[model samples]
Target chain A: MEYLIIIISAVFVNNVVLSQFLGICPFLGVSKKVSTAFGMSLALVLVMGLATLVTYLIQNYVLINTWFGEKMDITFMQTIVFILVIAALVQMVEIILKKINPTLYQALGIFLPLITTNCAVLGASILVVTKEFSAKGVESHMMNLGESVVYSMSLAIGFGIAIILFAGMREQLELSNVPKALKGTPIALITAGLLALAFMGFQGIV
Target chain B: MSKFKYLIDGIVKNNPTFVLVLGMCPTLATTTSAVNGMGMGLATMAVLLCSNMVISLLAPVIPNKVRIPCYIVVIAAFVTVVQLVMQAYTPGLYETLGIFIPLIVVNCIVLGRAEAFANKHSVLESALDGLGIGIGFTLALTCIGLVREVLGNLSAFENKFSSSDGMLVFVLAPGAFLVLGYLMVLFNKLKDRKKKA
Candidate 1:
């Protein structure tokens, strides 16, 4: 029940893209085509899940654990370490995918490198270690490793849903008559705002 | 070109938020209020300025194949410093800015300038470009924050001017997108007019 609540809350109520505002770059940049948006979403899910898992282990084991026979708290280096890890991880994943599965590699080729800087990947990983979440009746506490991975994947799904839907709308928007000044990004942003407002109605569901 | 031109260009022609549209995450997330927006902007500026100068200095030695990771390390180091100092001195703003303070490592504006301007330029020119872009970003964020605060909370810089409830939505997530969307339109129109003039 707790895991279910976590998934629901992440996907609907506190959406990563709509509410938290992470990864707006891809949300705006890649949403011009539904096919591309879907591809990006798949890449995000895979990377976000893996990144959170690795970052969580590093936080618990490497940062807070004993070092050189003396207890040391160097978690403040979390940002630097996690980014370097994520950067290296992305490269490794790309190389492995190229070797093992060229079909999937070709699909996600252009997006893998781009994911390095996609704040969503970094943001979700950071939130996993730092933030706490609570659904309506559940006790609020820091998520365990399993819960963190689940939450990260769900957040990525929420981002996927939002971007996919926005891309569909943008496809229609391309055919419509927008004001000359509000042609491209302006109109797209306003549409996103409306989508965000619509997502607000889901607040109390969890 | 003059040294000052680099700075001014960042503010006007290549405004990070308004014109270049880089670093959308912090621009949308942190601008719920004027003060929060300004704080985020200044923090980002400090990192951008430092990383730009360092990256420029190290550009010659960094091999082309590994430049991106090298730049990321330089950026991540400065971000760590900023994060630690903010946690020590201004805990309040630190809490409000939350993960974003650290997320500065991924902010495209910093890395963008490092690659686009710093890699090819001298340290001083890169620093000025960083400052220019930072100020432009700061001005844009503060403007968005100011508008949202006034409309959403009937306040500016945390001072509530009106007792009556404001739009409320403007202080929320959707308002950030809405405000930025319209602001982009306004900026576009103004730029067009300026071109004609």
Candidate 2:
């Protein structure tokens, strides 16, 4: 029940893209078509979920502990370290996928490389450490390893839903006649605004 | 001087937020109020300037294979410094901006300028580009922030115009999208006419 609540809230109430504004680049850049959006969404879930778990461990064990056995607060190194970790993780995933699932790798292709710079992945890793989550009027609590992993996956799921839906909207949008000034990104952003307005109705659900 | 053109380009022709459309995350996320938006922009500018200068200085020595990671590390270090300074002095803004500060490490504008301009330019030119682009980003954020704050909160530049007159949506996520979308349309229209002229 607790895990379910976390997933629900992360996916809808506090959507990483629509609400928090993380990962808007890919949200806008890759959502031109449903197929591409789906591919990017799958890549995000895998990378964000794994990156969260790995970053959580690194933060708790290595970043917080100095070599002198003193539990020092080196959290400052997080920005540098987590990004490097994410860069390396993307590479590893690419190599492993190529060795085993070349076809899937080909589909994911360019987006996999682009994930290195995706803010959503970096945002999830940082949020797992800094932000707290709660349910049912309970006191807000920082997530443990299990909770962070679940949170990351759900956040990615929310991202997936948003991009896919937006892609569908953009597809329909292509058929309609928009004002000349509002043709490309302008129309898309306004549509996303409406989507965000609709998503706002789900607030306080948890 | 050619250097003056570089500076002017960042502010107008290639404004990071309006023209290049880089660093949308911070632009959208932090512009709830004029002060917050300006704060975020200046913080980013600080990182951009320092990283651009340092990266240009090190371009000769950084191995090609590892240059991106090297730039990331340099940008991250300065961001950490900014984080500490803000936390110590401007605790309130620090609390508000929170994770967005560290997240600056990945802001495309900083890294993009480094890869595209700073990596190849001389130190003086790179530094000027950073300042120009940083100021451009700052101006754009402040403009959006000003619009959002006034329309959403009935406030202008931090002064409340009328507390009761504000619409809640402008201060929320949806408003950010609405305002930004309309602004983009306006900008695009202007650009089209300029091209024709």
Candidate 3:
């Protein structure tokens, strides 16, 4: 029941993209078609979930203990270290994707490199740090390791849902002929606003 | 001098958060209240300006192969100063900003500027560029802060000075998204209008 609540809240109430705005770059940049959005979303979930899991362990064990080797604490290196790790991992995935699936690689293109620095990935890392060490609240109290993983995974799923939904809306938008002033980013943003307003309904539901 | 152009570019055309969208983690994370927004923005601005100048000064001597690592070292050193200064004097701002202060070392805006502008430009030009962009970021984040604090929380300027109790959502995570999205819409509209005219 607790894990279910987390999954629900993360997917809806605390949505990674719509609610948190963590991945707006990709949300705006890549959500052109549902199929591509689905791919990117899948990539985000896998990347963010794994990154969070690894970083949590590293922070608890390695980051904290690096102070012992040197009198000067270097935990301040967390951001660079995590970013380098994520970037390297993303690069590895890019290589495999290129060799294994040229068509998929072509589809992903610039977005693949972008995944390294995507805010959602970094935000997930920070969230792990926040969730684990930060003072507990009612919602956070229910979370354990499994719950944490599920929540991050669901949060990424939530990101995909919003992205794919927005892509669907944009697809429909291409057919409509209305506004001259609000054409590209403006229309997309307005659509996002409506989505956000709708998502607001789920607030406090948990 | 031509350096002023470098400065103005950061403040407007290539503003880090509002325009370039670099280093958004801290911008979104800390801009809950006007106070916190200003605090974090200024803190990062200080580090950016200082690091840029340092990197630019060393750019001529530092080998290109190791440029990135050297920049990171310079950035990390300044970040340490920021962390210690915050820990000692402005504990309030320090506590509120939290991990973001340390995270500034990796903020793409700082690193990007170091590699892009600072590496090519003179030390003084780099400093000017950092200051301009930093202030622009400050302006953007503060605007977001104003919107979130007022609308989500239903009170404006609650934390301009040190006051604890106010509309909590302004400082909450959801409110950050709300403010940023609306502001983006508004900003986009303004730019569109300017282009039309």
lDDT of 3 by residue, B20-83 (tens): 7677667767787777888888888999999999998899999988777678778878887888
Say what the RMSD of model 2 is.
Answer: 1.3
Each prediction's Cα RMSD?
A: 0.9, 1.3, 4.5
Clashes of each: 0, 0, 0
Grade the docking of candidate 3.
Answer: acceptable
Docking class of 1: high
Give the DockQ ranking, best first.
Answer: 1, 2, 3
Give the Cα error of residue A146 in candidate 3, in Å. Answer: 4.0
lDDT of 3 by residue, A1-206 (tens): 66677778888888877667577767777888889898888778877787777776666677776564574545666766776677677777788988998987786655676676577786777676655422223444534566667778888899988998999999999899946555665577667757876787888878
Q: List the residue pairs that clash in candidate 1.
A: none
What ranges in model 3 sit over 4 Å off? Answer: A65-75, A96-110, A132-145, A174-183, B17-29, B57-84, B98-108, B151-156, B159-197
Q: Name the weakest run of 10 consecutive residues (lDDT summed) in model 1 chain A.
A: A127-136
lDDT of 1 at B175: 98
Stronger candidate by TM-score (1 vs 2) = 1
TM-score of chain B of each: 0.98, 0.97, 0.92
**Per-residue lDDT tens digits of candidate 1, residues B45-70?**
99999999999999999999999999
Off by over 4 Å in 2: B195-197
Error of 1 at A28 (Å): 0.3
